[model samples]
Structure formats: structure tokens, C-alpha cells
Target: MQEFKEREKQEQTISSPLSESLYENLRRIRTVFQTSHDVVIRELRIGEDKNIPIVIVYTDGLASSQSVSGFILDALLVHTPKVEGVHNPEKLFELMSTSILAGGEVKPLSDFEKLYLAVLAGETVVLLDGCAKALMVSTRGWKDRGVQEPTVQTVIRGPREAFSESLRTNTALVRRRVKDENLHCEQQAIGRITKTDIAVMYIEGIANEKIVKELFERLERIDTDGILESGYIEEFIQDSYLTPFPLTYNTERPDVVAGGLLEGRVAILVDGTPFALLVPVLFGQFFQSAEDYYQRSMIATAIRLLRYVCFFIALLAPSLYIAATTFHQEMLPTQLLISLASQREGIPFPAFVEALIMELTFEILREAGIRMPRPMGQAISIVGALVVGQAAVEAGFVSAAMVIVVSITAISTFVFPSYEMAIPIRVLRFLMMLLAASFGLFGITMGLLGMVLHLCSLRSFGAPYMAPFSPIRLAGQKDMIFRLPHWSLRKRPAMISKENPVRDATPAPAPPRPEGEQS
Candidate 1:
């Protein structure tokens, strides 16, 4: 069985050069695409006697009809002179490629493998009679959702444009922002069946050479049949998969990607996904937002600190409440303790079970909201949560205080700048609650310590996941937990840009002083 599977893989990868006979090539291609109704093949004559046969092939919907008709067909049928020399195979091939084909991108293909790949990728292929090589012209114009405002990483004071599914468009968006000679976007294909295009973008000098090489090697090692999203690549290439914390950060905003590139982090963009993956991400990076750079340093710092606070609230709010009410009631003020006791007077379940029920209900509502139709999803989730919580409280199944704690925790989860970062927090929240339920505050403290130890041990493409904090790098602290002024962030993250850390060379800007003022 293994041998048969190996043979199948070998046959799939085998490549054969095209024959000089036009009908022979057509027969093979037709056989391969016999069941595919959208495969288009048009035969035409282009000589004085109209005896020379040529064929143009492309996918019907994937290739642009306008480009095929105007650029390729018109150039061949009307522009090319119907002369005697056109009958000669070599002469005809040279003339068509050098002059007749009006398409800006035209390349010669000698193998059936490359020809099939090109045609499938929405490029028009021209095969001339008695010519072994075929010309692949760029005519890709499939339908796509154009750049829209970021839905996931929306910013109040930054560029509103987000990446689309098209890989070329996504690269173009990043290029428009980071128009530097040092910026490089190299393309490669992954997945045997899907042949999904992957673009690795980074600034040449600023990016660490070791990290870039390691990333490329890891991508090359991926031997999957299909890669439909950036998440697939993230999973395959990430340094550690055992932890709940995300090793790679994904964002839909091009500005965010461009900023990561400028900071010496490599961006992995999958062809069909709007979210691009940025590698070597640190724990602190998730708390930082694109808007942080747009706002004044003081305001940005405050908001960033708030996000950190929210992170803890999301991860520990329910757990702390359970621990305090169940085992540490003495720690609370007398008035607060009495109020909590009153709220839980008729509650049938323990603190842990009560919190668990409320948290699970909220998760259900949140998932329902996302899966339902967008127009009504938000409404259903909001209204359903309110009604359910009110009914539960009235029936004495859960206290109003429990509902408030769960609500605040849910809100805090949304505070993370990167949605991927919030996922682990949500998962860990349940575990933390369980710990609190079992051993009160001691369990919660142990869980926190374990999470910190796990985070410190984790790595993202060889860079410490808890960088500048675990290792205590003073250089990276400028942008961690606080939004320092742009001028203050003169160097890139040491682990990411080890080759060349100096990112900014300009002197700090200063306003002009009054003429009467003296130094």
C-alpha cells in the first residue's frame, strides 16, 4: 500500500515536455480536462494560406475575456501579417512572442506541467503548429472583494484599507505603504493540489537573515495537498504547537503588515486569505495596536495599559470572583461580603458551577452570533445574552454579580488588538476558573505561574515568545506595555532585527522656541 501511494505521488509530480505536434498536445490536455466544462480552447489559422493552426487555451471564468479578445486574439488575427514566412514554425513562434502577442506578460513554456499550471492559474496559453514551446500570457481577472475597511483590526486613526483575497492585490497594498528599495516580497507555491501562492515579505537589511532562512526552510517542508488559509501555514511553521498562546500574529490590515515588515518581521501572505501572518510575534505585540502609533504617546500609553489590564480581566475575572466568594470571603470588605452573600443567598450551585454555567452560556451566544447571518447575528447575540442572564438571575440559577463578571470578561476578550491572541485567553479562562474552584486563590496563582512559565519557554521561529519581559531586554521595553514616542523607538526588536537593529536615524523633532527664549 505504501509503495502504491509512493508511485501515485511520483506520477503526480512527473513532468513531460510538449511535442511539436499541436494535435498531440491538445489531445493530452483535453484528456486531463475532459470533465471540466470551464476549460476553453480556441483554434485559429494565422498564415497567408490560412493553413497554419494555433490554439489559445485558458479557464473560462478565471481568465479575463476582454484581455483575451483585445490583447491576445486581436493581436494574432488582425495585427500579424498573413505572409509566407508565417508558415515556418520557428519564424511563427518568434514573431508571435516578440510582436504579435500584445500582452505585457508573455513567457515561453516547454513542458506540459508548466503549461497546465499556467492555464489553470488564469493565463492564456498559445500553442503554434509544429512548435514545441507554448506562450503563457497574463489574463487573470477573477471576481474578488476589493479593499474594504478592516473588520478585525479596525483602527480609529489609521489607514482604513484592508487586504483582499487576491495575493497580488495584497502585495500591492503592502507595496503602496512601504515603498522602500530594501523591501522584498518573494513568492513561492505550496500545496500539491491547490498550488496556493505564498508571498514572504520582509525588509532586506533590517530583517534577520537567520530568521528569514529558517522561515523559508520551514515553508519548503510543508507537504500538504492543500493550504486554503494562512492559518494552515502558521500551524505548520510555528516553533511550538503545544501551548495555547499564538506564536504567529495574523492581521487583515495592510498597514499592520507593512509596519511589521518595516520592523524586520516577516509577513506570510496566503493567496486566498485576507489575513496575513506575521512571524516572531512576542506576547507584548498582541497588546499593541496600529492606532497606538497614530495617537499621542501619552494617550496611546494609557490605552495600551488599559488593554493589558483588560487582558488580565478577560483571563482571570471569573476565576478571581469564584475564589473570593467561595474561599476568601474574609478578604472582602464587610459591606461587599454581605452584598455578595445576599446575591448568592438563593443560588443552588457552588461558585465554580455558577460561573461555569454563565461563561458557557456566553460562549454559546457569541458563537451563535458569529455563525448567524451578519445582519441579525449581533442583535441576536446581544439580546439573547441580556434575556438569558436576566431570566437566570430571576430564577436564582446564577447571581447578578456572576452575570456582571462574565459580561466584563467577555468584553475584555475583545480588547486584544490581535484576535488570535484572545483565543488562548478564552481557553485558559475556563482552566483558570476550574483551578480557582478547586483550590481557591492558591490554584489561580499556580495557574498564572504555569502560564507564565509556558509562555517564557515558548518560541516563535526561534525568537522568545515572551521577549523583553522574560529575558529583560531593556532595548525592547520602549514599545512594550507603553507607547513610547516614535522618536524613542530608534531600534527594532533585538531578536527580530539582530542583523541591523537601528531602524530610525532622524533626530527628534522639536518646535521652534520664541526669539526671546534662551537655551
Candidate 2:
């Protein structure tokens, strides 16, 4: 009950007007921010006869000190402008807003809560002696990383730009790509204490309105004290909690977000995080890359097929190795079986144990490589791969066949376009290995069946996770498993966009006849 009261207090909307008396309003605001040392309250005497009293409230680190000092402080302090209407405080604030302050954005805030929130969020708020409303000036500034190449979603042929931590900059990156006027970005502030800004972006006509409404509703339901990153929003809004697979796809690439927006998908961009979340995510989209659209369809399609092939191999290879060598030796060829039997003769552990050792060792090394310093990480990954694999094989810690299988699985996991997709596969690989150890090929088959069933059952914001494959929407299948030529991809995924189906109505292209030939 105490927690509920606290939440109610935090979630209270700022609809009431500010206190009429300047002393009372200032006292109330200061009482709330009494513990905060970084907040600055500068009193100024502006307007004609220099009797008009005003106070500037802003947080120290969040706002640009230089802008406030140079533009606001200097303008009112030294170069004071005469007020035509001295008696009316409301008109004085209006006049000062228009002609007195010449720099940055200025918005009128009627509610004291809104004013204080804006002040805390880095905007300079100006309160006049008699006026009930305050002016919020744009002064947001903080040290942040500039636009850099996406470390995870890097592509060879596509644009190299990635999203930055700044919300406006990230949104601008998407806006620059999607020039359509119909593209809309709706903004909201979540987290009671942090008040993190989040934007829900989508194409007005193309994206499904029902999904957009649902997405916003879920966001509104998040009643946390703070949201540090996009991951928080993802966890709160994702459809299924039971599954490891991410229903929403997140990426640091702007071009990727723009492409999704064009395809009738909604994107959620969170402040302070480069990663942006895309809704109504599909399984096949995980295998696809940004580079696919940049290169020839044939090459892209071939690569897409390879990723899918690797997905299965990465998922089932080690399990199959354990099953075939342990339970079903007859499944292997005579010479291969003999070679495996010979290799296992000196080994102390069983086939499952052997494979488990190798996979865990590799995973540990891979993790170490990522967590360590970049230079050291690269060196460790290279040295560890060579030293560990060869040493394990030489020391008879694992069989040569098992090493090959584990290595192949690792390589296949790396082939996946998104790391988010690879993670679930990596986790499920162990379960499959356990199942195979118990029931061999039968166990493997059961594991696959369970995985497929879960996938079919999963829904990403009302859209089927395995769409164009499970429910078998024919229009959505054109770009699945294989990347049909752009011209051949006549319609968008029927599940995603029902109205904006056909993207290209033109027939396939053919070479023009010889110059002499006529129609």
C-alpha cells in the first residue's frame, strides 16, 4: 500500500496551474529540489525601471552552461530591454519571450510540475514575479558519443551511419532516410524518476494502426522508477515472457530502422541508447541483412540461404555428433565409425561429456574475448582458438570429430545476421545436446518439433512470429528463405501491411530490342 501511494505520487500528472504568487511558487519548487545541489536558481531584475523580478531554474550538468550564461543571463542582466506594459506581468513575460530572449527554443509552461520537470531535464525555466506561467528554454547539452559505425550490424555495401545516444540525433538519422511526409514519430516520457524520452515511429498510412495503438498502450503501462535503456522498454512491451527468442528486433543502424519503417513496421527509439527496437518482428527478418538490399538479389538470396543452413547446423551439429557417436554408431560410415571408435578409445569421458566440455570452453573463451580490452580480446580469441582446440585434440580431452563439429557450430552461430537471434539458438543447442544424449535421433526430432511449435505459437505485437512460413501468407513469402528480385517482390508482408500491399506493380524488366527494331 505504501508502494502504491508512492507510485501514485510519482505518476501524478501536472495539469494544475502554477501558484500565482512568485514567492510561493519558488518556495514550493525549491522545497521539492532542496536535496539537489546541482540545481541553479538565479534571480534577475529585468524590464523597464528594473523592478520586475524573475528567477531562472535549471540543473547544472544537464543544461549548456555556456548558452545560459552568454544568451539568457547576459541578455537580461546587462542589455536589459524596456517593458512597454510594466503593470501586466503576463504581457511582460510574453514580450520578453518574443523580443528579450533571442536564442534557443522557448516554450510556455502553465503547470509548476511541468516547469520543474523541464528544468530538471536540462531546459532553463524562467519565472516572472506576477506571471503564473513559466518559460522553458532549450538548453540541453551533455557529453555524448557522436555518430559512429554500427559495431554489430556492420554491412559492406550499405550506408555506414549508426544511431547515436542522443534522441533527436537518432530520430534525425531516420528522418533523413525516410523523407516521406507520412512518416510519424510520436514522443512520450516514461520512468517516474528518470523520465526517459521514447519515440514510437511509423509510417502513418503503411504501418498497422492497431499495432501502433497496442504498442503505445503497453508503453503507457510501464510503471517503473527509471528506464536506463531500450532494453527496459523491450522487456516491458515484448509479447512473450516464456520464450528466449526476442519478439522485437533491436539494432544500432539507422538505415535498418528506416527500412523497417518503410516496410510498415514501428520503431521505438529510446534516449541514452544507440539501440532502437523494431516491433512486429518476424523470424525470417532475423536472417536478413541490410546489405541484402544494396547488392544484387541473386547474391543476397544465396547468402540468405547460407545463413538459414548455418542456423540449423549451428543448432543441431553438436547434438547430432553426440547422438550418432554414442547411441547410433551404425548411422556413421564404417571407416568413420572405426576412426571415431579409435579416437574415443583413450578418452576418459563419454561422447556427451566430451562435446559439452568443448562447447563450454569455446563459449568461455568467446566471452572472455568480448569482455577484455579490444586489442587483448582479439589476440585472446585468435590464440585461444588455435591453442585450445589443438591442445584439446592433442591431449585427448575430446575427439577430433567432436572438435570439428563444435568448431562448425561456432562458425555457424557467427554467420547469423543478428546476435539476438544467435543467442536463443546457442542456448537451445545445449538442450538439444542433452535430449540427443538421452534419445539420439529421436530426441533431436522432438527438440526440433518443440522449437517449431514454440515459434509458431509466439506472436510479436499481434503479428505471427513465424509468419509467411507458419500461417503461410503467400504475399509475405516472396522475400522469405529466398530474396526474390526486388521487382518480383510485388507486395509487402500481408501480415504487416494489408493496405499497402503492392510496392511495385510494374512487370519484370527485359532488355530493349536492337536499335533498328520498332514496337
Candidate 3:
């Protein structure tokens, strides 16, 4: 036991040296990974007469093989002449500084920090013997997913390009949309083990500095082992972890990110993930899409109202049906009530039990449909619906009306523009169903009241979740449920623009026609 404990302690105490001799550290790394085939060390003899040996090291897949072979290796071997009895790090760096390509730079190998950073960025490091300097070649090329339309948030008429996994590419995309000089991008590497790159972007003049500072402070406090996705960072920085509602909004479109930046919001882009997270996000923001402002105000407002209505219908339709059938039969038409009772007569389970079973089955099928391949997804959904609805109803497991109600509810949930916002509604739907099953309409009213209370109390980045509506900002109501004309909306969202309220100049009236033929 003592020997094992000592061994465990030794293993746990293992740490990498931040400032050790370059050759010694390289030797240690080589010793640790002995017999590993991926680690390649290429020895280059420079200065034809002197034959100074330089070692170029890189990982296989992480670094570009073609660029290294064509540009770096050939440049060092053929272009660089052998030097005689030269061992100065500065002199060697100076020589290679002029030898390499435009983007590549040579520095001291003793600067191990920069060396590691270059390696992580897919560059090959060249180390010369007796010299403490290294030359880092920019050969950073790897397989990345092509820029395509975002699958989650598809629009009819808008920019189709979406962010890729590469953080540089994502930043470039956003930069292309916003040419403003005030747009700032600050980067930090998080995750104790993963060391994932995270970039925080916002407009310097538009975004609140206090909020940006708070976001940075919160992110710096995270001490996790890995952050493979943006969701991990979202949960880490959120004010309330237990709340079902999302405090941050996520998007793949650069235009959406740019729009949020212009509205004084911050965006967090994680490396190796296409989803970029937006901060200070409100409930209403999820319902409004970029395409909303692109179309006519009247059409946009109508569509927005329809989405809000569908949200409620999706959450409470099936539950309301169950409540009415089980305890509030008087509310329904007498003939319709009689028909429902006759259909449910042969079913073994109560309305609640039948509803729960159907809902659970539907949820399972939905999950399966999403996980299946694209070609087979539609087939699976169709067959699953037939099996769960028609066949099950015919077998007397549930009534036909229950199937119809549940199907409509399922379809309505998809009307939501944001998936993050839709999750809470799905969860609340189950709770509402439970309440309705217990006490009918009264239970649903109580559930709804509780939900409203919770939403009113919720805050995103210290801003109210249900803003303009609950706070009774009548002036801001023009863009709440209904979008007014662009000229009419002269101010930004009050919650996000408490300091700079005015957005644009007042509209000027048209000049009078002096001598026109028609008045």
C-alpha cells in the first residue's frame, strides 16, 4: 500500500517545465514518446561548407505535409548554404530570417512559449545545433468543413454562408459583414487540459464595457479539464445553471453575429466549433430572425405573432385536451364530448396515462429521426407516426383524438426559430401536462402563472428576460409583438441601450411638389 501510494503521488506531481534548456526539453519529450510513429524530427544541414545541423519537428496530420515538403524543407535544404563553425543563435536567426517566405519568421529556440504556440498553430519549428533559436514556418493547412448554410437556422432570403470550425475563418466571416473599425476581437485560451481557443467579439463604442469585463472575468474563472463545444462554455458562464431558459443565444451566421454586435451585444466564438454564442440575449431576441427585418414590416409582424401563438399551442394543446376530457367535460360541446367519451371508453388507461404514453413515444421517435441518416430520416418519421398513431389507436391503446392532438402539438414546436429557446418549452409542456392531468384547467392556469412569474424574475447579464412587456415600457412596444416601420423604430432595445437610447436621426418629411400636374 505504501509503495502504491508513493507511485500515485509521483504520477500526480508530474509537471512540464516552462523554462528549461531547449535541447534538454526536446530530449525529455523524445524519451517520453519513444517508438511513437507520428512524431517526426527532420535534421537539416545548413551552410554548405559548415554543415550546421538544424532539426525541423512537427506532427503528421496537425501540420501541412505538402507545404512543409514543398516550401519549408526545400527552402532550408536547397536554398540555405552550409555555414562553417557558426553557433550564434542570433546570427542563425538573422540568416534564416531573410531565407524563409514572407509569412514565416525565425526566433530564438529558447523562447519555448512561442515555439509551442507555433506548433499548436500547425507550423513546423526548425532548431539549429549550438544555437538557442528556432525558425517557425507558416505551413498551417488542415482539412476543414466547407462553408455551407447552417442546418439549424435556415432562412428563405438571407446570406447563406455560415461559420466554420476554424476560429480564424469564423472571425473573417464576421469581419466581412461589419467593416467598422470599432469592432474588437479579444482572444483567450481556456480549458485546463484542452486549451481550446475562445474569441470574444464586440463593438467597442456600442457594447457596454462593464458587461464585457464581467464576461471576461467569468470565463477566466472556469477551471474545467476540456471544452469540446460552445455549449460547455455557455453553461460555465451562465448566471443561472438550474434555469431551463437559455441566457445566451447561439448562431452560425456571420450576419446574425454582426447584427448582435451592432446592438451592443458580445459574441463568443469557440475553436473547433461553428456555433458562436451571443451574450445579453433576451427571450424576444430568439423569436426575431435576421430575415424579419429584411421583409415588409406588416408581414414580419404577422409572422412573429403567428410564431408566438404556435409556441403556446405547441406547449399546451395536448395537455389542454387531456384536461378537458378528464375533468372539464362541461367546457366542450355536448356532442363532441359524447363522441370523445365513446372513443375513449375501450381504452384501458386514463386520459393522463394515455397522453403520457403517446408523448413519450413521440419524443423517442423525434430523437430517432434526428439521429438517423438524412435519406432515412423522413421514412423513419413517417413509419413511426403510422405505427404510434393509427396502429396503436386501432389496437385500443389510445383514442384517435389523442393522436391528432399530440401530432399537432409536436408540429407546432418546430415553428420556433431558435432551438435553445424551444428546449424550455418542451420541458414546460411535460410539466403543464402533469398539472392538467391532476386538476384540469385550474392546474394549467397555476402552471402558467408560475411560468410567467419565473420569467419575470429571470435576467440575462443583469438585464430583465421579459423586457418591454413586463416592465411596461410602452415606448418600446412598437417592436415587441409587432414590428413598426423602420423609420418609426428610431431607438434600439431599451434593455441593451440604457445609456445610448437614440438609434438614428428623425425622418424628414418629403418636399412639397410646387408645380406638379397631379396633387
Give the count of colliding residue pairs in each prediction.
Answer: 0, 0, 12
Score residue 256 of candidate 2 by CA lDDT.
90
Q: How do all models score by TM-score?
A: 0.96, 0.94, 0.90
Residues 400-471, candidate 2, lDDT per residue (tens digit)? 888889989999999998999999999999999999999999999999999999999999989999998989
Writing each residue's lDDT as its tens digit, candidate 3 over 1-519 gives 999997665344334332324466466446544676776777656676635666777777778898888777777777765545546756766777675433444444445555665676677877765555566777777889868888888899888999999988999999998998988999988876578899999988688888898999999899989899999999998888868999999998899999888778899999999999998988888888888888889999999999999899988997899899889889999999999989998899998899899989998888888899977987898898988699989999999999998998988888888988888888898899999999999999999999999989888887788888778788778887898888888877778755466667779457878895597
Q: What is the TM-score of candidate 1? A: 0.96
Clash pairs, model 1 backbone: none
Off by over 4 Å in 3: 1-25, 32-36, 81-87, 98-101, 104-114, 499-502, 506-519
lDDT tens digits by residue: candidate 1, 1-519: 999997676456437788899999888788778899899989998766777788999999899999999999888888778667545788878888888898969889999888888989999999987989999999999999999898888888999899999999999999998998999989998998899999999999888898999999999999999999998998999897798888899999998898898888999999999999998899999999999999999999999999999999999999999999989999999999999999999899999999999999999999999999997999999999999999999999999999999999999999888888888899999999999999999999999999999999999988888889989998888899887888889888887777778778878999999899998
Model 1 root-mean-square deviation: 2.1
lDDT of 2: 0.88
Best-matching candidate per TM-score: 1
Rank candidates by TM-score, best first: 1, 2, 3
Positional deviation of residue 73's Cα in model 2 after best superposition, in angstroms: 2.5
Better of 1 and 2 by lDDT: 1
